[model samples]
Target: MTETFTVTVEPLEREVECRADQPILDACLRAGVWLPHACTHGTCGTCKVEVLDGDVEHNDASDFALMEFERNEGKTLTCVATPTSDVIIEADVEVEEGVVHHPVQDFAGRLVSIEDVARQTRRLVIDLDREMAFNPGQYVTIEVPGTDATRTYSMANPPSEPGRIELQIRRTPGGLATDGWIFKDLGAGETLRLSGPYGRFFLREARTAPAILIGGGTGLAPLKSIVRHVLEGGLAHRLYLYQGARMQADLYDVDFFRGLEADHPEQFTYRPCLSDEEWDGPHGLVTDVVDADFPTCRKHMAYLCGPPPMVEAALKTLMRKRLFPRDIYREDFFDASDKATGGVRSPLLKA
Candidate 1:
């Protein structure tokens, strides 16, 4: 028999059973209690909860998410922690009134196609067994068959299409998932298991401010979804998309983005930037480009998704332009450093 413990959630006054081998957040989701979470691997710190009593063990939490002070204050990341005993936790537990909270569902999907759009980036489209509904900027965690490991990728396409989702994955040289499985062996018609519609990085409805969407490398995936969502809804907020790459060839999906701009010329603006190589268009870091264009971002809502360094630099630039922390939403998917921190960066392996 498997060891199991009860988790008591305060404020909501709910209780759920967690297996010894599974994270607490997973248990909560399995019980249909949708707690907010971004990176379920413990890098993002979005699923933090205060332990009111009992003991919890950190399985694979990163220092970035669970700091020493936070740990001392009885805080734990539910996504990476399994309870050693029956525990009581305090967390922000509320379901949006009108929004349907889609609990995590096991989905089987066959790889429809994988085409190289850039030198090291591949665009993959999968047709699922059943229709999956997700908001813009949500991601799915795919189970690597024959292993306990899983990899996450944000949706590059919107939910306008039923039973399908697109992803743009950057090649990770020797990664277990990217190189070992996805690159070396994954083939069309191969069935894969995935679960989610995870993350709180989606677009906020009923916004009147102009939106600025920034992306780097494979981070363009979620931004692509956001842009398409806005366009499809015929929302009239001025939208600016700034996609940055190290070299010219690193840029992809230019024709599609250009087509969006052409259709909504007055509302949409596309700016593709290059940092390492000299380009006739914009030639600088993405943060520098944003600094030059929007000197004052008092009335702007910024959404950024990219490597950690790029997202950090852009955050500073946005703050300098007078944008409040609440006005700027970010999803830092990768760590660009050579450190073995598990992130979306190339060769980013999770132990």
Candidate 2:
């Protein structure tokens, strides 16, 4: 018999089962623990946890993922850590008392349409065979046949309609999944297998404060989902969306966002920032625009989605503006590295 291990999480005081061969994060996900995580391949450090007892091995985690100092401090990246014995660890708990997280499951879906939304981005619409009820900011991992690759993309549309999914995909320069299949070979009516409804980047129902939504490039997908959910629900809390791109051509879905602002001027605002090209509207990085507009965010909640560097910078700026760390949420897009290497993209794009 294969030896199984048990994992005890602190604060939440919960237990999850782990197989000898599987990662701790996978086990937690299988048990519906909803521990916060992003990259499942040890690239991103979002799944870092502190080991309190027993033993584990991080044979698959990258050196950049855990420093010698952190390891000495009994910290491990849950995504790559495999239990050698029953273990206890401290990690961020995301589950609420009455809320349930639908466990990850495989579903069949077919491509409905693909449209070029920007110079290097495409909007993909899919019709799922099963009703996959997911949070607005969740994503699904899609399998690409004829190649050992998959792409992670967040839904641009909310879960208002079942069996329907929409995604914005950015074309990587030399990506195996994007260049080979997503761009050149895949077509409508093609069947695809997907598993997920993963990610903790969704909107918090309990937050009644104003929301500041920020995104860069195709990172706007999940933010779009949240915005649609907020607007459709007729929430009175103010909403601000800041979308950044390199040039005007890189900007997509401006009309929809603009329409949203026009419809609810008192409750919503949209700002598009350009970094490379000269623009009459907001200029420089999205963080710069945010700093220029909002001097303080003491009472607002912030949701950021973008490249890691951009997300980090924006987070720092928001913190400087008086937003507490607990009030700020982020989802970093890891497409370039994951897609080029033919590895699974970070689950941030999935959920």
Candidate 3:
């Protein structure tokens, strides 16, 4: 058996046994340490931590995420680093009063159904053995059948439905999880091993400002969760959702959101933008459309999710429109392919 090493988490002063090959972030989160992380596959630098003592093996971390200079300076991506000896790591730990930090847990899920939602996207409905407590915008890592590889997808359904969740997945041309499995022979009633409530991309309820949610393609998954949460809980803040897609065929659930807008006409607004084709709503990039709609986004909270290009574009637009960086939250949906191409972000936008 491989020996386990003791990992001491700073500030919390807690110790946990980490398997020889386990990522430091995994060990910490499973131990309820809750280190801030996004895109847990090591492409995003959100899990970067300082190793105060001992050594670690940085495995498969993107050079952009954990640069050579940073590696030499004792910085490592906890999601890809494994402790080679007993060590202590100082993680960025913050506390927000209204946010609930749900402990991560594993569950066996049964695929209930999957149907084409858009041209290259599918909506997957999964039923878990037990309820999973996760904040809106959090995701789960699912172990691919017939392989040890895992893929993370955000829960599109709100937290109210704890035992069941919905996911909006866009098929990647030759992705291991997409083309290799999820879009292949995978069928209903198949058993899937998953673990979650990962990522800090959830709603920030403490702020009372109106929310501007922007999502590109399948990135709408988590934003759907936040919208449902607000509408269900009867939250007072107004919500504006902007969905960006290439064309009408790339858009899904347009009627569903229209129905929601009809129900809450005074509180919710949905804008669907199609860049490649003409549409009744908007005709340009989602960020450009939003920039035109809201001349100034003073005191408004922004939630952005999508490919790095879209997310960064929205961030720039929001900041330029006078939204504070502290009020803008974003989650970049990075795949392994992005690691090589690189999408290194400013540490100031770290969240």
Q: Which candidate gets the maximum lDDT versus the true structure? A: 3
- Overall lDDT per candidate, in order of appearance: 0.83, 0.82, 0.90
Q: Where does candidate 2 clash, by residue pair?
A: 137-351, 138-351, 139-350, 139-351, 198-351
What are the per-residue Cα lDDT tens digits for candidate 2 across 1-351? 778999998877889989988789878877777787765656667788999999999866655556688888899989779999999999966555445576767789899998899988999899999888788788887887876555678888887865889989988878777887788878899898987787778888677799999999998999999899889878666889999899999999999999999999999999999999996889899999999999799999999987777887888899899998788888877764632343333233222
> Which of candidates 1 and 2 reaches a greater lDDT?
1
Candidate 3: the clashing residue pairs are: none
Which candidate leads in TM-score?
3
Name the runs in model 2 displaced over 4 angstroms: 1-21, 50-59, 68-74, 83-90, 94-100, 144-150, 335-351
**Candidate 1 lDDT by residue in tens digits, 1-351:** 889999999878889999988899989987878787877887767788999999999877787567789999999999989999999999976565445666777799989998889978888899999988787888899997788878889998887875898999988877768877787778888898998788777877666599999999998999999899889888777889999899989999999999999999999999999999996889899889989998699989998997777887888899889998778878877432222453433222111
**Candidate 3 residue-wise lDDT, 146-217, digit = tens:** 887789999999999999999999999989998988888889999989999899999988887999999999
Tell me the deviation in Å of residue 9 in model 1.
1.7
C-alpha RMSD in Å of predicted model 3 compared with the true structure = 1.3
TM-score of each: 0.91, 0.85, 0.97
Off by over 4 Å in 3: 344-348
- For residue 24, give model 2's deviation from the true position in Å: 2.8
Which ten residues in a row are the worst by lDDT in model 2? 342-351
Candidate structures ordered by TM-score, highest first? 3, 1, 2
- What lDDT is obtained when candidate 1 is compared to the true structure? 0.83
RMSD (CA, angstroms), candidate 2: 4.3
